[model samples]
Target: MSIQRLIFFVLSALFFIGSSVWIKDEISPKWIKYQKEYYKEQAIKVEKEYSAASSAKEKELLGRRLASLKRPVYEVKQILLKGDYSWDKRLNGDKVDRCITCHIDEEKLKEKHPNAKEFPFDIYGCAVCHGGIGRALNEKIAHKGIYYHKRQMEQRLVAAESLFEFWSELANLTPEESDPNQRLGMGDFKKYSITGDKAIYVGSKKCLKCHTGLTSPHVERWLRIKFKTFELVKEAPDYIAGNEGYRKTCLKCHTTGYDETTGRYSEEGVTCEACHGAGEVFSYFMDIGKALEGQKIAKVGTFGTPYNICGPCHHTRNHEMRLKFFQERGADDEWFFPQHTTPYKTGLTEKGDASKSLPKIY
Candidate 1:
């Protein structure tokens, strides 16, 4: 072939190859950048979701933030293991002195059990239950205790009362009766009757109504603090569960009444009457301008007040439910309630056991 003809053929072949490459290369660097941006956006979304979740249980699943951001465990070991040792370490956010200074309970320990061994009580050590990085000398690791590996909130330990309450709820559940594959028997409410006044069990909705437009600063602060994922879920509808605007967030505390449906609410916000006791009895006098006059309102504690109500749930301990009880019962159920509160009497009886519920300490 002539030189010009050969050159013409090579140019045509090169043009075809270039076209094929362009057709195959669908993904560009810009496309990769867009994907990275997409993931970053997703991460932000999960963080917001975690922040918006009201229930602790919900928070666990939704929590997408890095572990370091969560609340740090205020460890007692760092202080107790330190030279100036003590029993009760009343820790302040990651401070050795804060804990040791308050919990020098060796004097108390000695007074109570003269024969018992001294400080850094392995059984009674702050680290045993409340975790922190024990070996760390720095304030962050020392005071902000150890991470709870098995549990959701890796930082501090779950409150004892919270654990107990969870157990109590579990005890009340009847998966065996509800599910065909279930092996265990259902829990019974036969031992001690649920004796609280039916009037006291107001649902969360009643609280939300007044709370929504309440004038007080306290009410305003609470409204602001309450978690909601309306905005994020609005864009990603698939991620959300309920209606775009209205949904139940208040049910976390203001539990549903016995007659009421599980999620349904008769009122809005946490009503004053619910916390202060059934206004049916108390409010009668209050309406007549003599609330404190005729008869004292019926309540759970001695004075019929909130301190009693909040203590059982708020001032809860770590081992809310004593697992040993379940062990003693020989019940190998996976859904074991921690031995929180007097379980048996409150319809949370262990398998076959008939122990009465403990007295309310409030």
Candidate 2:
């Protein structure tokens, strides 16, 4: 053959090969592999159940399930989420999430999200909380910016500028007037953001059930002081003399799992779960004798100092009585109330002068 003809034939062959590969990929996408694996596993499980069935009724049901799994319909499963505008009036219309196509194990997901009824996966979709490119079929593209776990999601929520906008929208105030850190401390932002796994507050009683035996001294000290903050606030001259509106403001800091919009709290006073995180998933892991797994979900020993956890309420910013009292006693403008007596600030770490420390929490 002539050299030109040979080059032409080679180029044609390459073009045909490329086109075939593209067509094959389009026909059987990445998600198809995952679906096939899931169905295969399910079929094996059903087959085992069928063999172990003691009754004809159970065997008949298992046989049907096995048959259905053997010839499963493989298709792109999607959740059509009805979207709304954000705080800045950004239109977020209908979204198509194909995440469920690959993550087809509904039972496993149901276990992870015990409160699935509240924020149904079918309605709200995965991207609403565990953010990612929901519509993408390719694994790499789909999980581009995905939050694989609760801790990552919590960090994202904490760092998000949208939290400030959301807080402003909820409080009927401007973004400048709103405090995202304060919202984080009050559990208002998290309550509105997500509701499953570590997001649901399981109360301090759940924490005490385990920790009381482990760290008796710490738990006892915490119960004596932190647990009595709500009662103390109630008996205080400010809370007693103030109106209903003023008392409502105190609940934001004085109580655990306070919902600013609903005007309700999960429990009175600053509990263990308040400083840590919601204890549902954490408790689940602990109960299953998976202490290391539980620690990953729990926010134990995460906060270096008490300032981040305590500054929301203990500071002199909004405390009119405390602020005035400190000012009258010739305190500096930067000086915060409830001063630390010891060199170790709030029993967390050693500092030169605890009183000189600035409020970095908010």
Candidate 3:
């Protein structure tokens, strides 16, 4: 062979070898390093426990744990999540969550996600609650578009910019004191962030089943007025001929469990769960004869006034129009209207009248 050809072959061989090594390192990556450190720590921990072990059986168990830790499997760890929990539903198949590869401390994760039954880390995985690329191995790629806090995900669902516009428009039209920039439902959003499943609304039928007794006259009254909001809007000539934007804006306040992104609602009209919150856990507790527990879990506004709860829907524009409409039709007694002027009371009960107090918008 020619010396030039021989040199070319040698260079080609070296290039292939270097590429192989680079690929191997990339495949193993930083997760392997983390696993190695974790194993070392575990081995040290077991060794200390073994040293402190007075009983023969205890020492034996500790010795076995130490041996296992010493010979730790340093590979990419992943939880094979059941079902396609991916953001894009087009990508069908069980999701592979490689988050646990680096985040190997299961105990630490358990501390953060306390409810193992509801959101099993093995089944649902990290990406379901905390948004991220579950299948990606590289740290940056894996954590891309990750939600560090639950509020971040909730705020995304609420579509804060759109909500701000809605609130601002209502505030401008109303005669009530209002701040457009205030965070309206931060506390309310916490109830939503419990689990992905818990975020769903169970509808008013579930609530009404328990609250339908003659003793709960307040609930009956609410059903008469508030529950008729969507019907009232639909019957309105303006709403019947309104543009999509106008209809959607009305639905935001009129309907329960309205999703701004999807432009869908769980139920028509402001149902029991609308102000009380999503009724999965609450209803579950209530079903088992634990009303107090259910109330706490639901985060029901029992102590405080219903100003914050009612303010979102009971703004000046809606109040003035709805009141005038109802009164003109001789249905004013049936419909509970908001107190448009100052010293506004949220007419939640017979005693307390509904108010035109706009929700704080920071």
* The candidate that achieves the highest lDDT relative to the unseen native structure: 2
Error of 1 at 231 (Å): 12
RMSD of each: 28.5, 16.7, 20.7
Please provide, for model 3 over 198-251, each residue's C-alpha lDDT reduced to its tens digit, 9 standing for 90 to 100.
456888887877678833888978888889867766866446656887678788
lDDT of 1 by residue, 281-351 (tens): 33333445653331344222224343434443343342223334334435432323323434333234445
By TM-score, who's the top model here? 2
Q: What is the lDDT of every predicted structure here?
A: 0.37, 0.66, 0.65
Count clashing residue pairs in model 1: 29
lDDT of 3: 0.65
Which candidate would rank higher by TM-score, 1 or 3? 3
Stretches of model 3 off by over 4 angstroms after superposition: 1-24, 84-93, 160-191, 194-220, 223-271, 274-362
Error of 2 at 293 (Å): 31
**Against the true structure, what is each candidate's TM-score?**
0.21, 0.46, 0.43
Candidate 3: worst-modelled 10 consecutive residues by lDDT: 353-362
